[model samples]
Target: MSNGNNRQVIRAEIKYPILAIVVLAAIFAFTSFALGYDQGQLFSIVVGDRAYEENFLHELFHDTRHALGFPCH
Candidate 1:
């Protein structure tokens, strides 16, 4: 009795061709640009959260307060 249960299975494979390379490269470049752009939006959202608290201009207020050595309550 021969059981072929234990065998190496290739989960994924890329075909070798000029068009394949071009298509993959285009996708990679597009994804890079899209991710970078989206990351900028994400950063702005996080910064905005930090920049506003208790009805204050939290970001600018921080700089001015620290520069003038004003007490932070």
Candidate 2:
């Protein structure tokens, strides 16, 4: 006589890929901003050959930029 209960479960493995995507996106965003690209200026930088006079992130986050001493002016 024997009584047994056995069950096997497998969980999907997707967290790693999702995390990688998020990290890459964050890096891209930070690099873009740090290099003076934000809002729609990324397009300009890619399409044109000259540096931009304004940064949309700086303009949009003017108060924050000044508070952080970013020297937007």
Candidate 3:
């Protein structure tokens, strides 16, 4: 019963790859742009130039943009 060697091994089960981090960062940046700086640009892709004139997104995020300190005017 007098053994001098006893050891325990530990392993981590979670892993984060560079690709996952990059994808998350991209999503965050896109969301920020949409909510803070979007002036109908995103909707313009589907609705054409009219989106800019309508300024739907701008109005939708207007109060939020101001609260978050984004220049809407």
List RMSD in Å for every model shown: 13.9, 7.8, 4.8
- Which pairs of residues collide in candidate 2? none
Candidates ranked, most accurate by lDDT first: 3, 2, 1
Please give, for residues 26-71, the per-residue lDDT of candidate 2 as tens digits: 9998874764435446656665533245545446666765676655
C-alpha local distance difference test of each model:
0.53, 0.61, 0.92
**Which candidate leads in lDDT?**
3
- Of models 1 and 3, which has the larger lDDT? 3
In the range 1-73, model 3's lDDT, one tens digit per residue, is 7585776679979989999999999999999999999888999999999999999988998999999999889
Q: Please, what is the TM-score per model?
A: 0.31, 0.34, 0.75
Of the candidates numbered 1 and 2, which has the greater TM-score value?
2
TM-score result, candidate 1:
0.31
Question: Which candidate ranks first by TM-score, i.e. highest?
Answer: 3
